[model samples]
Target: MNPQSADAGDRTTGRYKQKREAILNAAARLFDENGIKGTMLSEVAQQVGLSTNSITYYFKKKEDLVFECLMHTTSTISAIAAESAAGATPEERVTRFVTGRWKKLAEAAEGQYPAMMSFRDVGELDASYTKTIFSAYGDMFRRVRGLLAQGPVTSDNRMSLTIRTHLLLTSTQWTRTWLSNFSVTDYGRLAAYMCDVLINGLLAPGKPWAPTALDEKVAAIKLPEPSNRNFIAAAISLLNEVGYNGASIDRISARLSVTKGSFYHHIPSKDDLFAECVSRTLAVVEGMQAAAIAGEGSGGDKLAALARSLVGFHFSPRGPLLRMTAWTELSNLEQFYGQVQPMRQLTQTVVDFLATGMMDGSVRPTHQAIAAWMVVGAINGSATLDKWVPGSEKTDAVELYLKPFFCGICSE
Candidate 1:
């Protein structure tokens, strides 16, 4: 081999590699800023100071290049998740895990992938492109699930912990992706706070499980109580599928396959029914928390049980009522505060746990107001994200994401 020819060949290879990287970066920025369908190969090539023909030489199809760009972004996120996992303490790992992904989203917000929010939203429409993105976050998902399933280091497990973990991650990320109406700082802070609540609940003292109690009560009493009180269950379905204003007595009656007269017997009027639905849903949540508080367990166990109950119940079919409650609380500010005190009380239990934990040495010093709101937001985000992710097997996708944030704020 001639030494001069070898050096020239090496230089040629290096230049080609650099150009390819440049093209991929440009494509990602474009995709994150514009929808994948909105971006063009010519635009990508032009952005990178390359001719269309030159880009074609590297990537035959525009989509092939788009897929690569998505993959590149995913890879960056994967590296961050890995780094977070490798960090010294759970708290440091969580902060890095969260902040690192936030930085990635901020960077991409100016591009095409960010525009789409997440690959799962459009993966079915373009499988190859989404696959590349999914590959990047798969590891993070596994790590998150593993953490939640093990029973928190500070809490107890009352439900399917693995399922809850998956729900938490799915919902939190989806919220950040879809609800851009909220600021990024608020979303991130909210996610971190919710995770802390779950962690505190798991490790705190008490029997935090709910389904078990329902089972025991049913067994002992032998009474067939309504899984839901009266027509409240049917009313919730209508409210979720349609907005609160759209759901009327006629609609509820129709959904129940009963006459309006039959529905009237359950409640006084449409207004009463809507209020009842919200109250009943909150009652279930509060009931779970109450059970956790009263049960025999450590503080950590009580907290985890309450956390699991909150997340699990929220994902249940009736869970949409929680959103309805929030909407009502915000929209009818005059009436919501008075009518929704019981629901807010469930939230107070969470706030109380954090305040109690901080003072007792279970949780680090943190503001109850800030921490409580963060958990609430993350739970909301988790619900929003699950709707957009494609082929997501998770029913309770927010659990894992919430757990780490929960763990991050704990004493240990």
Candidate 2:
């Protein structure tokens, strides 16, 4: 071929790749905002100023596009982890790994690639494709876990490694939601603070730490007793399994092995039932907060107690309800705002506690708001702990899970 012809072909290939990336980036944003089930191909095209046919030209199916987007994210994260492999020490490697990813995510936020990617619909893809995607994720997880193991703070125990890695990774993952609402001007500062908190914890050095005593009174402050608990428990399970719209009263009743009339007898309406679930979740959370604050330990101790209590609840029978409610679509339901007030209150409670710790020099002098957000996000993300590490003992699980955020690897 002539030199001119070859050059023209190269330029065309470059344009195609650029356009394809644009589509994927737009699709990621839409998927994050509306969820995969809620987004349409046409919407993605509209965002990219292209046609649905053009999108199909690049990605033959919606599933293909979604899979590629997720792969792109996991691959990018893996690359970030690999980049830090040359660090001289485990602490340096872990810090660089997290900080680098945060900077990349912050930069990506300014363009088509949203800071966060969703794999919520990965199970809906082809078996082979799902395996490939999960393999990529596993690689990333292993790399981080390996780095943590190399560090001085991590343990030889498999459970400890698994819990710490999950907490660190998921805390970062949840930052996507945070970045969406807030504008970040300095990625370096943000990354440094996050790394510091996770690595060194919010606790000040030399502060006394003690486990909060768990007694019958504290344990009883959970969800309603068994008689009326079935309704909320079943609803939470269904919600986690099938989301908000799919978790209808009838399905919940079927799951509970009760008649529709019996369901109505226990709960007034689906919305009402959801509100009650939300209320119960808040109640349990508040109960933990109250207990933690009322304790005679330092503020850092209170935070640790709160983290342990929340994680323990995740392993309980009512854990699914708490987890599901945290991620539920309450905005679509009527009169749900009233129920959501407690969530805001919970945030305030966290903020106040962190501030108290800071004031008392029990916690580090960092951004209390962001630290609080990370704490709450970690707790909510623990909903998958059982699936992540099956048969993990409750006490051991809580200790390992909260270790990274509270004591950190360096401190330990």
Quote each prediction's TM-score: 0.45, 0.84
Task: After the best TM-score superposition of candidate 1, give how far the Cα of residue 92 lies from its true spot, in angstroms.
Answer: 11
Worst 10 residues of 1 by lDDT: 215-224
Among the numbered candidates, top TM-score falls to 2
Instruction: List where candidate 2 sits over 4 angstroms from the true fold.
Output: 1-12, 112-116, 151-156, 180-182, 214-223, 226-228, 238-273, 324-335, 393-395, 410-412
lDDT of 1 by residue, 48-117 (tens): 8888877777777776776656555556655766676665554455556656666666544544233213
**Candidate 2 displacement at residue 325 in angstroms:** 8.0
Instruction: Report model 1's TM-score to 2 decimal places.
Output: 0.45
Please report how far candidate 1 places residue 317 from its true position, in Å: 11
